[model samples]
Target chain A: MASLLKKLGSFAAGATLLFAASAALAKPLTVGFAQTGAESAWRTANTNSMKSEAEKRGINLKFADGQGKQENQIRAVRTFVTQGVDAIVLAPIVETGWEPVLREAKRAKIPVVIMDRKVQTSDESLYACFIGSDFYKEGAMAAEWIAKNAGSRSKIVELQGTPGSAAANERRKAFADELAKNPALKIIDSQSGDFRRSGGKEVMEAFLKKHGKDIEIVYAHNDDMALGAIQAIEEAGLKPGKDILIVSIDAIKEGVQAVVDGKINAVVECNPLFGPKIYDTIAKIKAGEPVERSSYNVDIVIDSTNAAALIGQRQY
Target chain B: MSKSKSLSPVWWPLIGLAVLVAVNLALNPAFLNVTVLDGRLYGLPIDILNQGARGLVLALGMTLVIATGGVDLSVGSVMAAAGALAAVLLAEGHGLAVALTAGLGVGLLAGAANGLLVARFGIQPIVATLILMVVGRGAAQLMTNGEVVVIKNDAFAFVGNGTVFGFPFAPLLAIALFVAAQLFLRRTASGLFIEAVGDNETAARFAGLGAARVKGLVYVICGLCAGLAGLMAAANIRAADSYRMGENMELDAIFAVVVGGTALTGGRFLLLGSFIGALLLQTLTTTMYNLGVPPAVAPVPKAVLILVVCLLQSEHARRWAVSLVKGGKK
Candidate 1:
């Protein structure tokens, strides 16, 4: 009995030491990534990048797909707070109605990192930082490239993305802003393609039949729409990549492939793959270093000059 | 069927389509222009035909299901599943035949499942089909892992974007399917059994007809038709987007079926009516687009149009209109 007691004492001391040792070194960061939803190819890439990036950095990621609903995102945030995660990452589906849920996370002292879309709240403390491509910049980048390449007086028809979507609205705004600088540039027609390949194709076909060769440039909000417009252009017996100067955003795989194939003239990168960049920010924040309030991922203006080389590295 | 009655159901939709076309012609004379370029027909009319082909194909199968006192709400989801399956199969280096078979097979099985639920399990057709309408889209998303699966195959591409004798093959295929469906019903006892079962199930069963088997068979055919439509849509765009490919297509198919004068209560079916109805809907949409109406409000006019068509199809409304016209003449 005495020997057993001695052994128990030593084991208790060892247990204490082990606990002390672990307490001395902070526990690995556990980030709860509350993804908006995998509604599109971009969303899929965003989710995939977060997951794989989390695995690479040894961070425990609690993922919840909100299925394109704000209510689902709010519920997932509540669950993450209850789980006592180190931090929370949110790719908001919409721009409003997040104050209450965000307050709950803030009350728990969990720093939130917003990605993809913005939260409408004015409070800067609601999130640790915003990490994504600047929509306004993405728009300007495409417009500048188009205006420079196609000359100022080119006839442009815009295939806008889904109406009321941030990407669509902001991109359209930036394009308008840039077009003002070039007085000769005229937008002959504009319509919403809903950011789908099929929509782009249908709308472009209508534009072709209506306007014919009057349309010199097709400004699609995203690559899918641009790709769809290419089909329409080809069916109309016109070369897409050259005959119609195609400028779109989001360097997705097929879009880049099209650029290489000489279908799309230029694509502005939105960089949906946020894994490595996100992890780097989290590491800095954890190390007691100040991070930027809004970190914009670098946007690239991809055209024939660099499209062929970058097609292999394209993530979304 | 008698020659006069054969085209009876077709005339209303045909007239409606012609009227819309005529209005478009007056507004924009370019709407009637058709030209053959490089062995393919190209024009606004042909574009409308291609656009309507997806819904027309679904309407073809939906007509049969509605004929048997059942509605398959799962047609749209089935289209997504078939498109995703075919896309994934082709992406995995499988032959076009394998992909087509597998895609159609998924559709048939999905339809069969709906049939079983309603026929064998005694569930309401709407509720039974609703289960698939919700779940099958998820199944499609899973098949593609929530990404648009883009593929390239010459033969498969030909099915969607190809032409037969210089007309778009998709519209032709829908017409062929409608004709085949019409012949199958008119030439065989299946049509009588279906009409009998739909009109009164217990009475038909008492009359020694297999009502459950008939309902199950129609649902299966409905699934197969949706599968073909899904394939055509995916092929048309050369990409299978499970999320958006067949999104809300069920409503379009149902609209075509209803506008074609197929009563929701079920008894008789009309194949050509659905075809013309599909064409009518497509023509209206093209007109709206050509007129530069915002797409958000595009559905508003369609809603009004369908309401008018429904009201016009009612016996009381038809009798009232006829009486008023005759009284004026007197």
Candidate 2:
């Protein structure tokens, strides 16, 4: 009878400890994600990264694909608000018409996190903050590299992205700004590639035909165009990395591999995996900590040295 | 037909091509420079031919389809889907033949679906093909799992990037297909039937021509050509970019056919004229890049080219121009 009572008391104590441990673990935060549809590989990688990060952090992510439409995003935001989510993450397809919906979320008192794109609002208090990769800085970095590594009196051929696009405009202006500081640097020919491999190749071929030996370097806006120009340069009997120094942005797998192989000189990183940082921001905002109006993702430059080590982690 | 009428629309595209080439020459005297480097013919003109090959292939089927009183808006999607399918197959270590067949087969199936709806069920060609167009893009995304499928295959890459007699195999394939199509339409009675069906559907039905079947067959042909285009595109890059590949190609093909002087309402089609039209479009693109034209307004030149070609081919413009020439003589 005494042994039975002692055993029962010990079991009760263990059960009490288990209950306390269970109570100590906090419930996972519920976040609703309104993603711009999978329009490209970069976007797909982004979506995957978000999903995996959410799972790792134990955040319940409510994902909604906007299919690259503004109206779809609006509807999605409304639905997330209805679900009473703790936080909302939006990767808007465009930069306009987000005010009305954002005001609604603000009225609901749900903290909203903007990802990948900016929303122009007269009122800054409508959302938490905007987090995205900086296009201007990426281009500026490329230009800085060129100004230092490129030989004096280098005739640069630029493969611009689609004209009028934010990426294209910002990258072009920032690159031009850097080149303005150096009298030896000159962009001989600049044309839009529409951000495609084929477009890049056609434009590069034309530049090769027109400029010939006058072109000593290529500054393509992206890796795909850089790769295409490399093909054109090879066809023209000019070595890309040797005769003409090549520089491009975006450290996608193929581009990084080329860097490791010595075909391309440098690539600037635009990290797509924003899940951990996104939720971290949410946690901070929820805890009443002050946050910046805009959070910029770090764009790291990769050359032959770090490219081999970093190639395995490339998602695209 | 009178000599001017016979030469009217045909010679105009040739004239446009000559003018563009001349412009390129004046802009850069090296435009005509050709060298045999690494056993392959390398030049600006060869690049134009190779780049124009996709448009050339698409225009061929589009010409036939328009001749049969049909228009296909799904060629772009089909091209994307075919490329995606080939990339998937090649990346999985499948044989080149199997991958090509599967890619082309998807094109055939998509075309057949378009055909069955239009020919068998009497649906509008545009609507039927549009259904496939939207679906094919989505399917392409699904097939590649929304990722780029890059293949490292030499044999498959040769289909897109290889050269024959120092000329790109893509253009050779396009030329061979163009000639074969031209002969098939001119030599065979089936060609006349297709033209008849396009000219007068009801009258042709009374004349016992299978209008639906002809319309269906043309869409299938369009699909097949789009499929081949997709394969070459994937092979060229050794990867399938479903989102980007074959994008806006359908419009380009339609533009090529229209610039070639084919009446959209249906009837006689021109192969060589369409070929020249394709060449003109590609050359204009090359010229724009060399001139350092912004990509945003680059299409302005192409739009202007189309406008000029269409106006020059129009009956009223032709009459006015001829009268002006006569007035000058007087």
Candidate 3:
């Protein structure tokens, strides 16, 4: 009877321990986020979005800042793998050189989700999904807006971003392609502003001197360059929004503000807030559901009509 | 021969500038056209001067530094740091005077640190300045939290955008500083001391020329010039971008100094040559823009043009070319 009573006690204790272990397992999901450093205002906003979203969802997050280095990001990934994170989110700084580390994550079955920039790999299985803004579409949207709004014979001067960068290449190609549909809207001159305000100002000053009032439209890859061009235009004794219709991408706070001020005609939004969408995608992946290999966040066009109301919503 | 001798030091850069200007004019007949609007000069020529102002100031300091057989790789970074400090100060509601002084002070302090490292500790100038080059940008980024600090003060902006007698203030300030420095250096024993130390530090020291002190002093002056350039760049944009402010400007400054006929090996220096060199480079950039050269292909032509000018600047290359032409004619 005594031996039987002892066995019953042991079974009860073992059953309680199993129940506690199951409860712990169902507590909350833990995720590891590998960010590509706070390099710019856009990047800072992206990071904040992710962090705040994680907090709102009650996920245990392990954050790692790569500090603009690929090696550091790789190390962070390895650490996440070792920690046995439920999911891993990576914002790669470059496209290539991510396959090996990603292969390791795949082996761990951590479900890596790429954000903002892209990763070039033959095996798409290495990453669960990629969520980023479509640079080409953004450029096309800007061009489409111009074709509809500006006169058919409008002469456009394009201020490109840094040479050979992904954003610059795609934006330039798409804008040119879209503008090709409307041959009358000719790009009179295009130059690389190196995606810098100073570059934009200098190039705009030259363009103003060379082309003068002949340029009716200034299409810049990014808003910083647009702002710089606005300064150049103002300095040249011409009203920016009145004399030249300006269209640009990346509706950063300053860019949106410029639209609100009526200095810039329109700005295409390249939304940096990826937190909510990323979490939704992760949830689908967690539920053992099929997910798209690559998904683009739909961008919006912000003009004077919506700019003022949207300005307060801009976090970056 | 007399004409060639008179133009020997700065003639090549001048020719390059003239050629580029001629090319721009060829591309567009209106390239040289200047008009006044709102009491300010508006033209490609004025644009070149205004845009080249930062590089001109940097070259001014770099010329002196190179004359002493040293190069300050930190000028660009110092520009970023000083501009960041000034922008941050103004953003926080500080007076323009305080902001300007603080910005200039950062340059002086950074220069003094570099001087101490090189002169006092006997570190190589390149390595010593390299330390600041690496740290200065980081410091600037830290101060601005890696975000651009937008400045909204018109008084400060005037330094970069405002014109005096229809000329951009930045270029005018640069020219005025160049003139004053030229007079001061050429009219005093200070220039002799710098040359002596640069030529032979041991000989200058043995002759009681205070070689170390001269070496230290040049860095300070360079720092001050870079600081002012930083302020001008920030004011022009009305924002301090710690990341891109003065990026690669040290290289431009060095190129300007070298193109201006200053030997990297030390001793001989040309202040006016650097000024023209800076203008020539700016003209090349403007020419590219005026011609609308595709961004990817622009660098190739720019490189070729710089190579030709550099080759022409070489006495040996010119003599060899002349001899080759003579032989071919025969």
Candidate 4:
């Protein structure tokens, strides 16, 4: 009986040793996701996607909502670094003032992924991959559509997004670059709509009063502004799509629906639903697989031609 | 001539507003035309009118509250709560009259809670109202499950979107409220009592002015203004997005009141000045947009303009300017 007990004890010790070895080999990946506030439906959807995808992949996602404050976001990043997260994802509030914190992340040897918004850091090597719709390209696409639909002689009024945001900057740059291709396409007046419905409306109203019938096209950086501009246009006793062509980025459901209603002329899709792709990218990096530095492409445009068909599938 | 020499505080703000308008016109000649009025008056510009109307109403109530040596930061949040409640009830197919009545009732209840906390418990007005300011938005968000409730009732819509004699109903409603408040303050003993309590609370208390009761009444009045503002906002957009409803409105309202020549330190009230202040802010924003300035950059000019106005109004600034002029002459 003593000899039998000795044999069982040795067997138990061998099993424990093997378990320890496997445990040492398999390390859990800790991912920190700093999100912008759930200010809009698109932001909420983006957050949910990231969370659900993280859960499915068995990655620990440490989440923080910035509440539209840059300071809060910077603090969250510092907290993530102190907690020794394996990877980090940032959806920045603005384009500047991130180089120092990003350098800290680099020193900590954690891979960083820029989720939706891009930052204006001089160093490009600090992040692993940027996963977002190309805002500049999206803006140019909207402008191109307007140029094609409205012809070269149209007098355009631009409705810009949030002042210092990458989306706003890139969209404006790209739109201007495209419009520069057509000299006759004069941008009569431009103003910051602040990426809000009311901001868009107020600016549009002022634009209408200043330009009157000479105003041909209304180009907004986002759908909300476009929608707001449409209200202003209609309120002035002018047909929105017929009299003043409205084109905007962010093919959110409302924008697409507006296209269907013939209230807006065109909508350039800026897909906010980027969840599964982000999770897979993080997993690939963890497994020592080669991942592209910039992976996603902007969505296709939706206009009156395809508005009815695509409105049903539009999400945010 | 002697009475005219004793300049009313209202004239100061009015003069400042006129000078600012002149500056804007000088900077951009197209700013003064009525043709640009149509587009600017629709969404964002119109929303400003909406905000101004609401701010005027709240400031009118706040004027009373401040007169009683009290402050109410929760007016914006109360507006949100009222909007949320109204939106939810309306979404549930409740009668327009019923929903509006319930909204006002809720506002009164919220005000009463604030009043009771401050008056009955002897809590500081700022502290008492702060509690609601922080939690009221959360309550509003929770009420609508954080969803934007799109209202469809035309009767409810009329209050927000409809026009009266070619004038937007909201601005008109605000004007009506301002006139009523002006009448109340200028022609009533209750207004005098409020100002008396604010000027010297202990003295007013000693004089048997029922200072606590007067203080409580202002909070209720402030809540009612917020309720009305919420109704107008919900109607104009045909939706209630609690997330952004009346966001940072308290700051704007306080700024309007302060810029209107109502002392932040608390003493006198100016109904017309507050109204004009609201209009000034909206016009400034509209003008900035019209002048081809980027939206983000608008805040910079606005900040500078406000600083200039405030500095001009400061006694130290006024003295310095006068001395500089005298020195220049010498």
Candidate 5:
């Protein structure tokens, strides 16, 4: 028993010395972030925020811009895997084609934190936590604002974002769900604006030509489209906020400005500032603390009344 | 002597444009409009002009390249590189003239690289430009470290978004380039040499024309056009997102050239036809979006329209349609 105690004491001292040495030589956490390309101002800001936050935290961030291509993103993720990063952050371009790659990350025991966008995988174990605005809630907020302001009987035109995108899919589904509650609230015309200002304007112009007086409201998936729709409405000799009420997601500064200027009636904010929250999660995971598998409910609705005040504080 | 039974290429694309316009007008009469013109100059019609301007500029240079029996797939990458360079320079507080000059110079250098590879090494133009197409974007991305460089200079902004006598500067630039190219090609011996080289490089060389020099210069001109278009696009948005800079632009330029009645196999060039083709393409996209088609589904109608136009332009398809009409009448 005495000999066992002596061995135990020596082992304890050895472990203590090893721990002290490790603490002394502790390197900054290395993170691999595979970002979707700067397709929008929000995306650009997201990337900048990540880099700045990483710098502030003294974490080594190995970054890759996927340029909105799936193949490039896959390659980036595999590269991160090969680099043996402690954790991986992916702002996925699309949702469906991620299972195989994510499985690979899981096999490697690398914790993945999904940022800004969500993946549609059946296995929840593949990712640690998804940090993003609830896209469905955002879409529903836009729909609810439209219903309240434009009346249930108002005819609406929807300008969707890119097809097959998780945000676009969820936003569309949620808006459709909300619209189902009010039978008189009909979508007379709907088109994909491809999440671009020019695309939105072009489509809105077509909607104006085809639907004419039928379109009483424009429910855009994002503010850029709403802004474009406003231009189309104005060009068609109709007042945008007055004649055709507009509600959209993504309360970007320009979108807020549009609301304040009375061009768009309301905007549902999909907060692009996920840096602080993401860094906190990463730190928590590194410390072997419990982290939620899903982070939900990060969205706000800004309207004409509050738009002016919030525009100054808006980051993206 | 019997006239050569060659097809008049211009006849087909014009007919196709006419049919598309007719269909669009029939579907929605508001499509045919100049009413809002100057009043809502930043409206949907203006957006169409913006999208077409880049394609128009690229097509102009592509016309010369195609006339020399060569293709430059690197035009899009060249645009990205130029935009990246301009953004970096402007971000560093360089003067507008210096930034513009440097941007053009970079474009010229990239073009020269393509010209050298093709002229000196006798590499296939497609293969030569393809290498740059893949790597040039990477170089541009590297220049910005894959970050967007937003600019706030009013003078530079005017080049893209500013209005000149109530017209957007981009379209104006495109028109100016078109006019210059028209004058150069119609009234110059260089134009004849280009045609000669495209028609038969051996014959042109035998006739004492400097075929290599003409070919090299055409690519340089193509590069300049792409570079200018890139600068305009970056300035218009007041930001340079390298990833999206000139993405898939080469396809649009090629489509414009093909739809403009420029033969893909080379020989002849058409400045007016290419401009019109660009305009028509933009108009079609704008019209389709306006017609309540979902964004995901917008490409479908565009593809269908292109197919219809292609079929209508084909002598075989036209002959088939005529025979069916005749049989029905009998």
Candidate 6:
């Protein structure tokens, strides 16, 4: 009887110790983040959002800048896995060459949350969830606005993004697909601007010379290109918003201001603020709660009505 | 025979330009149409000149550098840094004069550095300029803090977008510079000196030519040209995008120099050929847009066209083609 009681007491002590150790491990909720380099305004804003949000939530964040290289990013992920953080966040620079490093993370039993750009892997189970903006939705939203504002038989010209880029291809595809529903509305001309202001201006100038006054609407894949088209339109002695309806995506600070000034008629937001959504998903993962495989931050369409109010609030 | 050969090479780019224009016209009847809008020219032709102005200016400097048997890979980066400095200055409420001078000064300094590396330190031109090519953009990014710095000054904008007597200022500036440079090269002994140094630097040095000084000066001139091009690019957009400004422009400038019949191995250079070459490239881009060619397949056609032009310019290729034709006839 005495030996049995001693055995029960030791088992109770071991159980208590295990529980205390787990509590200690779960308290800080450290997360490792591998970021794409601060190559642009949007990317910088995304980085700032991640940092500020982590501070607000009292979560420990380990940040690594990939400096626009996939090798550096893979090295960062390896470091994160070795560190044994509770979760890992990756803003992949490219889509492939991630399987091996990701497999290492999987072996370590760490959940990875992919942010802005996605990684391609046959094993979907490698990542816990993907948190990114829906580029297709942003394009569809812009096209929907065009369909509503543009009357029947409106001829449109599209300024595409960099060729073969996910954002460019998906945005162009979705816009075309959505606009296909309306038979009368047609894209008279489409060309890649390489997602640049100068390219946009040059291409728009050619489109104007080719199509002339027949072009009724201009849809640009991004704000920079739209801004360039605005210059081209003005140079042609035609009012941008008044003469040709302009629809653009990314709703950047300049894009929003252009909307308020009545240059761009519509801007579909591709929110770079992934902080709140990222943390919410992380919290769920920590609590053994079910989370969706992929979730996109909600984006809104900005026009004359809300552009004035929102222009001042744009961080990027 | 050498003079004839040299002269014939220059005509190839001009011929290429004519051919591209014809192709554009065939595809779009309005390809050559120019209309007066707000007293300024608005047409694909004008657009080509305006858009090609940056390349033209860069190619001018590149041609000189190439003539000296050196390449300025840093010109693109110099453009970025100079534009960033000017944009930041103008954004901070500085006058256009201050901004422009400072921008040009940055170019001169960057060129001097590259010249120092190549001439003073005896480093390879490719390796020396590659240092700036990598770091220059980073420095620009640092200045702009990774954001596109927008400028609102009309005077500054005028440098890029303004028109003089219905002609764009950028192209005019480019042409004026070209004419002046061409005159200076032709009228003085400096052109011969540059050619002598390029053909054989050791032999030129032995012959009492200031080879290093000539090399250093070309780099400075190239830097200045790139600086002007950078400012024009920034002014054109009314903003300074550090990341995107002057990206891959070195390759374009080199392409222009090569296409203009300037031998990459150095010694011989043609300014007019480069001018036409730059225009030819811009015409090709505009032609692609006018045709509404999908971006995915665009590069293939562009590559094929470039190959054809290059083949036509090559004596060996022309000879081979002639032989193949004769053999087929037999």
Best by DockQ: 6
Residue pairs in candidate 5 whose N, alpha carbon or C atoms collide under 3 angstroms: A192-B294, A192-B295, A206-B290, A207-B290
Candidate 4 per-residue C-alpha lDDT over A247-285 given as tens digits, one digit per residue, 9 for 90 to 100: 999887878988999989899988877878887788888
For residues A1-316, write the lDDT of model 5, one tens digit per residue: 9999999999999999988986788867889999988656778778888998999988899999998898899899988988899999999988778988999999999999998777899999889999887888888888888778775447887888889777899999999999999777888877887776655766786677566678888888887677767766775678988888888888878778888899888889888777778989999998999988788647778997788788898766
- lDDT of model 3 at position B135: 93
Model 4 chain B: lowest-lDDT 10 consecutive positions = B35-44
RMSD of candidate 3 to true structure, Å: 4.4
Q: Candidate 1 lDDT, tens digit per residue, B106-219? A: 889998999999999999999999999989899999999888898788789777888989988988888888788789899998888898988999999999998999999999
**Cα-based lDDT at residue B250, candidate 3:** 96
Q: Return the candidate ranking by DockQ, descending.
A: 6, 3, 2, 1, 4, 5
User: For candidate 3, what is the DockQ?
Assistant: 0.71
| Lowest summed lDDT window (length 10), candidate 4 chain A | A193-202
For residues A1-316, write the lDDT of model 6, one tens digit per residue.
9999999999999999999997887677789999989877889999999999999988899999999999999999999999999999999999999999999999999989999878789999999999898999998999899888886538989999999999999999999899889888888889999999888998998888888889899999999999999999998889999999999999899999999999999999989999999999999988899999988999999999899989878998
* TM-scores, each model vs. reference: 0.92, 0.94, 0.94, 0.85, 0.80, 0.94
- lDDT of each prediction vs. the true structure? 0.87, 0.87, 0.91, 0.79, 0.80, 0.90
Range of the 10 consecutive residues with the lowest summed lDDT in candidate 3 chain B: B1-10
Which stretches of candidate 4 lie above 4 Å from their native place? A1-32, A55-62, A66-88, A92-110, A119-127, B1-5, B20-51, B121-127, B145-147, B290-297, B311-320, B323-327
Better of 3 and 5 by TM-score: 3
Question: What's the candidate order when arranged by decreasing TM-score?
Answer: 6, 3, 2, 1, 4, 5
What is residue A116's positional error in candidate 4, in angstroms? 2.2
Model 6: per-residue Cα lDDT over B76-165, one tens digit each? 888899899999999899999999998899889888998999988999999999999988898999999988999898999887888999
